[model samples]
Target: MTKPIRKAILPVAGLGTRFLPATKAVPKEMLTIVDRPIIQYVVDEARAAGIEHIVFVTGRNKQVIEDHFDVAYELEDTLKARNKTAALDLLEKHRPIPGSTSFTRQQAPLGLGHAIWCARDIIGDEPFAILLPDVIIKSQVSCLKQMVDLYNGTGGNVLAVEEVPDDQTQNYGIVELAEKINENAAHISNMVEKPAPGTAPSNLMITGRYILQPQIFDLLSKQDTGAGGEIQLTDSMLKLMETQPFSSIKFEGRSFDCGSKAGFLSANIAFGLDDPKLASEILPFMREMLDQPEAAE
Candidate 1:
């Protein structure tokens, strides 16, 4: 029988050099999006997909992320004493169940492959999902939930993919699909990480959210660094595809790459526009910014 996917690995060890000063002491995953940290959105997606345990592959200065998932006794008590039921309830709603999360250190910035490998012990002998906290997928049905539904039926290896512009294809891992199962699904025969500009096989790119069989842990066990002197997950996946049934499910949503300055700003704006507390205040502020003569130039 195909083992059910119950655990998810979140790699949060990357040094956010792009956000430098802001991430100087804080882990990038703790950066807020409409008041909730980026990792919170990723965890919410995992929970929605019925994930029971979340394994975080962390590094230095990532203690805040662990604390974010833990209960704050004093804060909860203060909110309860002040009759802030709504605030207290909101906090409780997002908290992960006690002992539902496990943390392990990646030890080095080897690569995404190594980061995921760090969680190997926690994910022994079962299919697991890997989620990148930097990529926030906005959808009616959470992206991971959507992928989990596909994983149940297909079960070998599945990736969450989306269409990208031809020119933008060089920045992501591109795939060469064999056949189309449906509009949003395809059989991926092969994949290439960041192909040269204009040499991409298809516009589809593997963004984030992967459901991989446990055997992949073996492939990653001795993976050599590729593409950038770092062990890349795509390289390991390419080797796995030689034998496994690999497919990509295009997500029905927008993805915000919150790892860069521009993408981070865009996510803040996008989520800010969706939040009730910030909507009214930001709407006029945005309109005024757009109306400024400098914007037209």
Candidate 2:
């Protein structure tokens, strides 16, 4: 029987040290790409993928994230009183149904694996999805939805992967293909996290989306520190591989790593250009800046 992936874990406990100063006071997940926060995009993707429950693995000073998804009674009342139908509608559209969202604290700066473990009870006895909040994928269909479709067919662990240049394989968790399932999906025989240069089995790097079974919780519980002395999710996943089959799908989308300044700016521009209301204004401004680098100055 194929288990439905109804819950998703979003590990958002990391301090955004790379984007300090701005991130010093604000949680990076709350940083906005356009009008919506980065985390909103991630949540939207999960919702589109049929996830019924969302588990946010948060840390200190990340209360804003919980608040963002929660109802703002005062704001909504004020909008209603002022007859601001559009604003109220927008809020209603994005607000998760009551009891659909859950938040738990990681309590420390442990790695991604530990953050996820914090939500194990909430995700009890079910296959679930894990979406890294910092990575945003802009696709016609949500990236997680694509993975869910593949998971529904294959009935095992499924990861969203993308082909990277051979030279860049060491920067990612690369997978070794065992059998060619199709043009888009494959049976992964092995996974090497950040393999040394010239030694990567394949260039298909793991993107931030995953559909995993509940047994992974057991593996994560006993996982040791790896790479950075923090419980690494990759380490646990590799161990889980010994018992289960793993598959990958080259999803149709462009992913932006909003964790970095450059990727953040790129996401802003990409999303800005896609917004019908902003595209006409932003595209012209971007072209002007590019065509005449010093004219505006």
lDDT of each: 0.90, 0.93
Candidate 1 local lDDT, 1-297, one digit each (tens): 578889999999999999989999998899898789999999999999999999999999899999888889999999989999999989989998888999999898999998998898899999999999999988899899888888787778999999999999998989899888777888899898888998999999898889998888898899688877988888888888888999889988889999987888899898888878789898998899999999999
lDDT of 1 at 233: 88
| Cand. 2 TM to true fold | 0.97
| C-alpha lDDT (0 to 100) for residue 199 of candidate 1 | 93
lDDT of 2 by residue, 148-213 (tens): 999988998999999999999999999999887889999999889999999999889999998888
Candidate closest to the true structure, highest lDDT? 2
C-alpha positional error of residue 110 in candidate 1 after TM-score superposition, expressed in Å: 0.9
lDDT of 2 at 64: 93
